[model samples]
Target: MRLNRGLPAVASSLLLALPLALAGCTSFGEGSEEPAAASATPTEVEAAPIEWSDCDAQIQPLIEGQPGSERDLLFECGRTEVPISYDEPAGATLPLFLVRATPAGQTERIGSLVVNPGGPGGSGADAAIGLALTLPQDVLGRFDIVGFDPRGVGLSTPVDCIPAELKDRVIASEPRPTTAEQLDDVFALSREMADGCAEEYGDALGTFNTVDTARDMEQLRKSLGDEQLTYLGYSYGTTLGSTYAELFPDRVRAMVLDAAVDPDTDVVADAEASAAGFEAGFDAFAENCKGLIAGCPLGDDPRRFLEELLAQAGGAPVPSSEEGETRQATPGVVLTAVQAALYDTASWPQLAQGLRAARDGDAKALFSLADELTGRLEDNSYSNLLDANLAVNCADTDEVVEETEVRRLVAEWSQAYPLFGAGSAAGLFTCSVWDAERTPVPERDAAGSAPILVVGNQGDPVTPLPGAVDMAEDLESGVLLTWQGQGHTAYPKTDCITAAVNAYLIDLVAPQDGLTCPA
Candidate 1:
């Protein structure tokens, strides 16, 4: 799945609305029993404990300075080394970066509660700061929030494939190639990206698979002195969490997986589902914006209007201006802007404004949204998000359809889902030529594990609700919690959902199966 740049509004709002609550008397019982040893040999010599230090210089100052964001100042940063290949514990190792925030005041701490904010590429250390600030006080008091950048992400041993200049060109390339020349260019760029990674990292690229990361998580658990894993994972993070549960079923105390990625979904099915999801989200946005806004940009038929707009951009790229830097908006940029907005309905108003501006021949708003989605900063420097996302995803799955099949799917899906199908299909070639040994997504039954909570949003565009449903059913003890709402994940969307998750994580009382909260 592509990265969803939008943060859950409920989380941000909660952080702004409430001051950090000091810890109080809250006793979490002893941790769960340890599971059977993993298949990989345990290190003969235990790894050194993490050396904690103030992270003021490392954390982003803007987030630290935000109101009610003291946790950023309180966070401690550190690094730990683990074997890049778990099968060879004495072989090459990679350093994993971590950020941890403890409770404000003394309380009976449960243990370190690990978190990953989706991405397979997102900086979990960065996410920990946000999670520390936004999570409810009661929940905050009971657990030490720890976020780690996985083996090939963020501050960890990063996978730098494409250079910034080349990446900019790639992201701005034409999304839906209609002609042979354009298609050739698309294929060339895809190979360029994959080959670049192979050249930079060599065989090490194959070690970034989720299964390896799952082993790294176990090492992290031991390093943190936690008896078992307690986790909160969203979107792609759910994949990591489920993989961990599958690999070490008895190692879990509690886990909350929101906006799940179905392990069973192949690349083609993933593209098709994502296309339908974005179309559904767009339809909902169009219906809600009809009478709510004056001169709705989409008019009566949003589907048709968007299709025409995409076609127009493809033929002659729309010009976009930001802070005097001018660039043309290609179909790729437009689609990225749309996908970013689909993550959270709170951005729907901005999406409307952007679409309206685009219709009026000004693509500034849309370009800004696209820049945000792709992590293009004000200084034009890009993060390694796109790089690591591709690396990890390519390493995880082996399903690769040929360009001809992808083109056929695009043509068929474009007719079925006019808003996003062709563009979604256009993205199918990203991992086609990746040079990593594939690790199939695990079954994630997690039999005999503690009750795991799976939260699903009804109208999630990226990881649709059905994936969550399938994920819940796949896990032996999985409890499904439904949030009848919009957006990518549900925990930070509603009080009802948040309360349910908080209860699960802090109290280990999973919400009833089939529980549904209204939008």
Candidate 2:
């Protein structure tokens, strides 16, 4: 299936409280509000749990037909124009794109449930429309699942920097900046791309960070004519959800942040945690594959196979197909593929199968699996979202280092994770070269919001489970819901999580403090 971030620890950590930017020149969420004339009573609609009647009639038929599967899902795109800078409402205008599924039946809509799938770069508008059929039935029934291409993402006025071939080249390269020249080359290339992105996207690229996106969410909520905003954000989306809750607690109807990031840490810490997570994932793979050598051909010694792959690929890249298309097939790719596979245990067998193919001298299977991990499938073009990923990450984070400093950081991280840390550090080099202005530090606390739910997976590798616990501790109203699961986000993998979250959405039934479930 689709990738969920990575192992329980890292994937979940990144999901917990990651803060990043979005595309679009807009003010961060800030504005004056008039006092309510009177306190409003809770509607009966709010008291009942999610019911079929809650779903908007306008969007049901489209759900019956798988949109992405058919490619027939009509994209109803609209723009929400917001101020370039929230601090200066008139500085400039940035338009955001919104996509919705038409309700299947002819009934008045109840409200909209906005979605953000994460990545600081993930496109919710595409996901909502494309995956409409697969969402939890109760969720679909109650509210119109609305998705928007966050300011700097797909379908929105996007950021285009590096050429597609160049991006692929970079992504396919080894993650290690072993030589000084190699490190310098990495820095120079990233700097050039960052400068190019800013030159192309202009001031809008500078403003696409997470805080602004959170504000955009508020504006979108207002534009939709909803009294309260209900939302589901996964991966980096958890940051968006938490930020919104902090900024506008009173406006929150319900929200579910699956696989959350630690809200209080700097990006350096996030990256470090993510590295550890990958190691955890590798361990999980080793554990599961050890006894199944006949099916899992990386051999019973996971570490040995991983090391051998890295050494071999690092010395000489492997051709992915007979056409001579090549990739390093290093541990990073193996780990990336493994991370993607960990999203659903159902894919464990597939990963094993790919490993078997690689062992047999057919690298195509491994390459194909790695492609899915990096989102570089044969039919799909490289996304500028990767540029946006850097832009927004640089803009929102307090952690930025020069090449020298990055090298030091990478060295330290490598010690912590001998297998994958160096590569991740090298991969994140783009942030150093990005020109987007930094926000200085996490801004959610100053936003002044509510107790948002932060979910974590016990074995999460990317966004470690501790990240969620840490995030919960940071927020005044934050509550922790731990899932003893293996994926990035808990909701998709477990019915228990869905039920708890649905209860929160429909009847304001928050799970008890520190609620947890078994893997």
lDDT of each: 0.76, 0.62
Position 299, candidate 1: lDDT: 85
Q: Report the Cα lDDT for residue 60, model 2.
A: 37
Candidate 2 lDDT over residue span 256-365, tens digit each: 77777777666566677777887887788678877674655666686787667657766665555546464546544655566666655656777777665664455666
Candidate 2: where are CA atoms >4 Å away?
A: 1-77, 102-110, 291-295, 322-335, 377-380, 445-451
The global Cα lDDT (0 to 1) of model 2 is 0.62
Model 1 per-residue lDDT tens digits across residues 241-325: 9988988888899999999987677888988898898889888888877767476767887667777888888888888756566
Q: Which 10-residue span in candidate 1 carries the lowest summed lDDT? A: 21-30
True-vs-predicted CA distance for residue 407, candidate 2, Å: 2.3
TM-scores of all models?
0.89, 0.81
